[model samples]
Target: MKKNILNIQGVSEISKAKQSEINGGAGWGFGGIDLSKCGCDCAGRVTGPLYCQNYFGCLQVYTCNDSQES
Candidate 1:
């Protein structure tokens, strides 16, 4: 049997994020979560725009799994 696995990391710099879509309401507006950037080709999930304080304003984490066996 043979198996293959790979790990990769990258930093995506975005000029601006898409504005959150808010539903009309009387008080607070319920809206979708905001992201700097996100997408995955494999079985995976997007984790964060976990806030940061300085020049790097936020982080978006993508964890993916693509494997094959023979």
Candidate 2:
């Protein structure tokens, strides 16, 4: 079970787009998380503000690649 952690905090839009590309290329689509499959329970979204009183929050995505054993 290999884990990939994606941080969408202060990165540029291009970087974020690249992340989406990587996920989509891997067959995860725009939603990214595919919890329907076995061993995909680790896939989820994490979100929180960067600071107090801030409206915008960053996101962190947790995904698993079970194709290869760890």
Candidate 3:
């Protein structure tokens, strides 16, 4: 018997409005962890700050600053 494997990859550009929502927009919306705090130039970097882990569990931020160990 033989098994087959599939490899797939693609890129899609997102508008600023959408990115804002994903990055956690302000107000009563589901948005937190400002990417700016990470001090990373996502546009110039190949891999931007993708995710982070803190005492509150995994979070979506450019960087994780949970210095104090829990």
Which candidate tops lDDT?
3
- lDDT tens readout by residue for model 2, 1-70: 1122234455434567677776332332444333333221343433332221132222345556758677
Q: Worst lDDT window (10 residues) for model 2?
A: 49-58
Considering only N, C-alpha and C atoms within 3 Å, which residue pairs clash in candidate 3?
A: 24-31
Give me the candidate number with maximum TM-score.
3
| Poorest 10 consecutive residues by lDDT, candidate 1 | 50-59
Off by over 4 Å in 2: 1-14, 24-70
lDDT of 2: 0.37
> lDDT scores for all predictions?
0.35, 0.37, 0.40
My TM-score estimates for the predictions, one after another, are 0.15, 0.15, 0.21
Model 1: number of backbone collisions: 0
Candidate 1 structure quality by residue, lDDT tens digits, 1-70: 1122222245333334433443353222444434443333233333344321211332344345636687
Question: Quick one: ranking by TM-score, best first?
Answer: 3, 1, 2
